[model samples]
Target: MKRIVCLLLFCALSSALPVYSLTFAPAEETAAAVADFERGQQLFHSGSKERALATLRTSVQRDPGHPKANQAYTLIGRIFIEQKRYPDALLYLERIPAVMRSPEADLLRGYCLVQTGDFAGGQAQLLPLLGQSFSVQDTELLLLALTDAAVNLQQPLNALFFIQKALPLAENQASLLERAHRLLQGHLSDIELEEAAFMWQGTAIGQDARLQLARRALGQQQQQKATHLLQMVLASDVTFPYWQEAEMLLQRSSMDSWFNRDSIGVLLPLSGRYASYGELVKRGLELAVREHNRTRLPVRLVYRDTAVEGVSTSQLVSSLTDDAKVMAIVGPLLGAGAEEAATRAQLEMVPLISLSQRAGLPQRGDFVFRDSLTAEQQIQSLVRYAIDTQHISFSVLRPENRLGEEMTRLFVDEVRRFGGEIVDIVSYPEEGTDFRKQIQSLLWEDYVVDIPPKPELPEFDEFGLPIEKKEEDKKEPEELEYPLAPFHALFMPDYAERISVIAPQLKFYGIKDVTLLGINGWNAPELVERAGRFLDQAVFVDGFFSASSQPEVQRFVELYRQAYEEEPTILSAQAFDAANMLLLGMDDATVRNRDDLRQRLAALRGFRGVSGTVGFDAMGEAIKQPYLLGVKRRRIVEIN
Candidate 1:
């Protein structure tokens, strides 16, 4: 019965035909062929590819019409494909007659055709199966092959269609969407494009089609037509993927309608988990605006709270750009919300300086800029300082958590790049207080304590009788080893709360004369208040230090204290710098609209702000050195 089942599976045919067909063969010959086929399958699974192919071929030659013959052919073809022997795979796959060919066989053949550059043949083989029900994986393969074929043949419409079909199965959806937009733009006629726009309605591809049409209208000097098309997109869906481009087009069509050069939009989470952060950033932006207005031609500040229910960053950005017509935007302080706002600002073609610490926010577009200090920036500054100070060898005693792992990885990579070696690495739980074991692991063999000799036992008597014993020799107790620390430095990528507890433990273990490295989290007052004696001379990095003697920082801090009557945090300082950069750029008479403001901000260099000397690189990331700080006399102070 097992042999019969194996034979039936071997002869299973195409989707349109019965899997098994009635055939007569001598029992012995059929059994031998089946045995060969099973052995070949086992050999293939065991990685003996050449032997498996030889076995499968021998089975096919044994009984050409046996049910196992077709199975052998299929396995042989699959092996060829695996070996990248495309022509061999094609040869075997073509031998299976079309009427008996399984969907799997057709897929294999299509793959071979594509690999061999016979794209048209591949399309012919795979396109028919698109209508048939197949496994998700097989469907993905078909669409990928078709996409490749169409792209090779310069058939943009077909390639776009295949990509749209593959989107649900694609892991890299963003890449496919981007490729789809590129394919549709300037690749199709008006009528064909209109069909696609209608087909993919409410999608990025569809919105891009309308954008292309608007571009055509503008090129032909049809201002009203272009404006109407772009307005249609914005009116229907503010969440439309390409709405920003549409808004920009509409603004270009009628500059007077949405070009308030004197207005700057502010998007912040003023009511939620991040409300406090929003308030800090708002205070700084407000201070900078007031100071800017006093010097320049008063620019109006328009504020929007992102935490409003039923209102998204998309709608807020639309309101700011389309209605308030702000020349540029300041922030959405949190990561997720900041990314959304940046995407909208990008599409709207308004310059936005985001204060969120999210990585790659600026890559959204040319208009998006990030002014916040990031984990990478902090680590870079700390590692650079360590290398500069000749701290050659290091050890890491980090918390067993995500931030700890990330910072440790960054530190190790940077040290390796600077030709320094990491002597030891260990982690302690964030919730733990006893770090003695973890700290002990970082110490060298010289630090090991000596074991005292066992106390001398009394002399035993022979034959159950006590023997006279001389007085035992006296020995002093073994002393503990207190060796000098081996590593030049130790990096603890955790908060000050944990550092205070960990510092004394290091001292208890005789770990001294080693430079302690830290992230921004160590810049707290409690760090000094709790462990000042242990952490004296410890260095850390941060975007802002209120006690700094820099004139710009002093002025900003004084103004912030006077207005809010509270100490400003890094959030406030970064926002102030971002807003001031925008406001200062707006002061230029040539900056008449958002485009001009974007150019001015992108080209900004060496503008001193409270945070640091603010500038922008080509990717719109802030170019500034974070402030290096250290504990001096138990006080956190800016260090040279």
Candidate 2:
């Protein structure tokens, strides 16, 4: 069997077909606008495109934000696209607000752009839709458009991506087959042809691809391979229109093969030094699988423990891949383990979502996803909130360590991005308890040298000799007046243990009025118990907070407590959310494949889970909007 080489996303867009878009119910606007839009839609459906366009225009003029207006614009734009009126279609489509526009509208717009020979812009719009749709029809349609654009752009491999996905979810198999035949006869080369053939291996299109491969084999004088491929094609369902053709080729001579498409691997350190952490992750996976049990897909969970004293991360993953026949892997929490698994997974083309926070982990490849929160996220969250609250100037009190330095850089970048200033950065020894010097330096900045005081001139006696000021005769000078600290916000992106001590010390040193900014580490209860009064109104961002009153979050905390007999740790929350996302994506068998899983992860948006809102960036790194919480009455409270 030919391996589906996913060398480029561009190759996935190898052909074009009718794409679908999303639609929403019209908001209650002026009855007239609604009526006009409804009428326009009816007319359009009734074969009066021109009348419908007029009515839609009238409706939009009355209330552009109305659902009716969006629907009308969508219809009008799509009609113009079908008519090859690219400019008109774009004009109509652009009127609908992005938030209100449907996937269908976006797809149609892309189609129109492509039709006008704007292939790049067309693909730009269409590519993002890969795993977003809740509807298979929408997905198929979008894939079709991508395939056509890719083929036209001479990226036949891109066509393979679209067709393979389009094949499995094809409600309109006839349409896909027709497109495939056209692509095979025209743009596809031997390699591209092989890629497409393997994508649809069991489906009807697979048979077509097989037939082509066989013919190519015959042309190449490889009679045995030709007969084998032909036999495979003939073995496909007779419902396919070309079954007879397959038989004719098969009778010449051949061979065959089959594959099992069930099982995913869960690799965790279940019985070693990292057992506790692995257990938390495992619970999350178990919960996710239990929840997904309702779907009843044939896929099974194959669990492997990478924790055996002698078992290396590579060995553990290899066992699952070679022996277990797993489709994807979720695993090993430690950075070293995650890196090993990532390298192996990337090399093998297996999808792996590592719940490790190692910097540059996901950079290993497209197949490796770092679902854990990163240092950048922690610092960026603190900086963003500080800026949003109009805190223009900031100070940093970080530990003298690599983490502190890393966070400091990230904070500085974010501050500049959002137009804020860094007043001072003071780093104390990581293990130091007394930060008096750092705090003093942050405030006073070596005042003896930086702000030298002028010597007092005493009154001279009758003689010209310099007279020393007597204790009884001279007046005493008042206390020195210190300048106010330059910054209004102080960022400390370290753990609560050190932060708790540092925060109180800052107050003792009179670093008042500056908002105390921290990352998830400060979300600990110790921060509240030890420094709550000091940090009142102080905000810290976190990926998960059990204290959140959000109903879903509350439910998760409760369930976690009941299941684990303790409060859910950040590890549990993050792992649960990550696993949940994978489970949800796995609902579609067609999308459960390693490559498909990665694509689906990128397409996830605003996925609300125990670990706050979870999404993935284009690079497959976690994109979470950290919850900014404040200390109030000795309790952590959501800071809006």
Each candidate structure's count of clashing pairs = 1, 25
How do the residues 110-159 of candidate 1 rate in per-residue lDDT, one tens digit apiece?
98898778898898998888888878877877888898898788787788
Off by over 4 Å in 1: 1-256, 444-480
Give the worst 10-residue stretch by lDDT in candidate 1.
Answer: 13-22
Model 2 has an lDDT value of 0.73
Which run of 10 residues does model 2 get worst, by summed lDDT? 15-24
* Strongest candidate by TM-score: 1
Which runs of model 2 end up more than 4 angstroms from their true locations?
1-262, 294-300, 448-482
Cα displacement (angstroms), candidate 2, residue 85, comes to 47
Report the lDDT tens digits of candidate 2 across residue range 1-106: 1345653433554332112223323455457788998898899889998888888888877766554667888888877755555667888897766766787888
lDDT agreement with native, every candidate: 0.81, 0.73
